[model samples]
Target: MEKTVSAHHACVRTAFENTVPAAPPTSDDIWQTPPPAPAAGMLDVCGRERRLVTRTRERHTAVRQLPDSGSTLENVCRTLQLDRSTVRRFARATSIDELLVKATNRSTILGRYKPHLHQRWNEGCHTSAQLHQEIVALGFTGSLQTVRRYLRPFKAATVAPPARRPAPRPRRIVRWIMTDPGNLTADDAADLKEVRTSCPELDAVTHHVRDFAAMMLDLRGDQLPAWMERVLADDLPSLHSLINGLSRDIDAVTAGLSTPWSSGQVEGQVTRTKLLKRQGFGRANLDFLRKRVLLTP
Candidate 1:
């Protein structure tokens, strides 16, 4: 009986040892193993570097095609709008292919933190500003622009489809409605038609706007009174207010519309003066600004 009990205890000990997990490697052990090199696809050239490479190759090809003259390098540089050093570098190269090989892409400031960015993106942190702040805490010294560019593709992939009945923005809708019907595309026209169906008042307003635009374009001031009456009769509070304001200066408005003589040139000068004032604000005094404006052709 004693031998049987010892055998059972030995079996239980063996089973428990096998079931228990081994201790994970310590930080010291992890530090001993060097990380594997990143794949080629993991690194990318920025837009400026890519452009530089492309320009170099193009210049090299152009240089090769030109005749071997003393002024050839100068002419190539002038034609390509490249610097003398850039042209000489390409000229010294053995071949166009050599120029390509010489174009090396420098690593970006955020290159080291790309893996962390991917991990955070996959875990659903999509806000670039938030990611920028988080990475800053993790010793990343790159600008928010760099982080934003890196996360563009990931953000695009994770974007939810727009809502079925997205509310129209007032300014955009007004711009669309105010644009000439001829200028609007078929899609825009169809969209406007849909919106009109949703709100009959908008449709009424659109017709009135078109009519008023036509009268102004044709200089038919005779039709202004009738148009104003029609607008006042409508329930469009905004148009009614506009008509009331116009009524205050109806004679001037009528004369300006009917006659070709206008303050357009004077208004243009006024706009220019205002722009000059803003440009020189706090930089130059009003007297200096006046002299500059008066002296300007």
Candidate 2:
């Protein structure tokens, strides 16, 4: 019987995940659920690589403290309250330095004029104001603060360009994907738009997610097969697995989408029964526990 059941019901990673309440979800409930959080692994726009490095170091340290950490990615994810993707990324990393490389290795607009900045600094132009003015005259449109921060790291370097890697861009991709567009911050909207424009694959994902959201909002379960077909047609391997999951119990999923029936009461009873069973450990026999659970008001 267990083998006959749909894995979608048991698997943490499935085609779609919802956190509906005990009752059938209303339109509001759909929106009120915790929005999908995207890659929860970006450093703030602070000027310190150390800040990001420290965070990556902490995650790596936590991973080491667990037994056979690679095989226990889910356990680590729960302990850290991190996204599964983030946790998987940590588990796959060869070392802290490797993870830090991804966190640190990024390009920025300020990259193009490094040579001029280095030349001026080496020629005794130590003042950021002068450097900023010079670079601005050379068509640099970035703020004077960019120049100052770039030069600040130089204070500790030995005349070479500081090994200071740029911080990864602030990614609310997952959050934006999971959240209603109406609820996004202006900055978040702009960032999401930019990300979609930059990566066609991510843009496709955004479109698919919004499509799924529409299906849910309108209870369009009949559209489920069509949606799966669309996903299958796409080049996204990640979503293909989800389509496979849905196919396992397409009829049930379709019914669920078309109707409001839910097993809330039965699920509640099961939860209560489990609670009672745990409480009765070493104190009551199975017969007594069963009677207590079934007879309790």
Candidate 3:
């Protein structure tokens, strides 16, 4: 019994000694130090270096194709827009195939956390700000912008299509729908028909807009009162306000629509004045701007 108890105690002591906690890794041990430079004949090149190599190969081909002449080096330098020494070096290269090589981006600190990020993305944690916070807790030492750039493609791919099509701007849609039916394409007419069917309020507004446009184009001031009454009966707040303003100036509105004479010349002068003002911006005073507008033929 004494022998068995002694052996058990010895085993326990051995186990305890074997399980002693290891020292934590130092900062230097955690980070991998980069080599001074890539070794010669490495396949991986940066984008700029790869472009240079391609351009060099093309120039070399051009140089080799030229007929042998007294000034071959000078001719290559002038024609190919390359330096004398560069052309000579390319001439010596035995094979252009060796220039084509693979390009690899240098690894960043965030590389270690890429697997975790992808796993989180697959698990539905799509917000980069939130992911950045979570990875920071897991010992990531990269910026939020870096995380955002890396996840852009994944987010774009995962976005859901909108449930309903967005409506065009109110004025633009109104103009297109109210214009002469012959002026609109079949597709536009179909779209307008769809919109009118979906929204009864918009359908009412479309009818009012068409009536107003026809009255303006045909000079039918006699129909203005009935049009105003019909529009007032509708639920269009925007058109209601416009008709109310016209009601306050009914005589002027009716006369302008009925009479052949228009304020078009006055409007043209105003437009020309504004244009001249813009052209002489910063340098012209009000007097100079006025002179340019009035004096110019």
Top candidate, metric TM-score? 2
Kindly report which residue stretches of model 2 are placed more than 4 angstroms away from their true locations once superposed.
1-153, 156-172, 295-297
Candidate 1 worst ten-residue window by lDDT = 36-45
Model 3 misplaced regions, further than 4 Å: 1-172, 277-291
Expressed as tens digits, the lDDT of each residue in 96-180 for candidate 1 is 5334433422234564455556666767788899988876775667899988886775544654221112222333346667899
Error of 2 at 14 (Å): 30
**What is the C-alpha local distance difference test score of each model?**
0.60, 0.61, 0.59
- Backbone clashes under 3 angstroms, per model: 0, 3, 0
TM-score of each predicted structure versus truth: 0.42, 0.48, 0.41
Using lDDT, give the best candidate's number.
Answer: 2
Query: How do the residues 13-49 of candidate 3 rate in per-residue lDDT, one tens digit apiece?
Result: 2232233222322234346532111111212112124
lDDT comparing candidate 2 with the true structure: 0.61
Model 3 residue 140 CA deviation (Å) reads: 33
Superior by lDDT: candidate 2 or candidate 3: 2
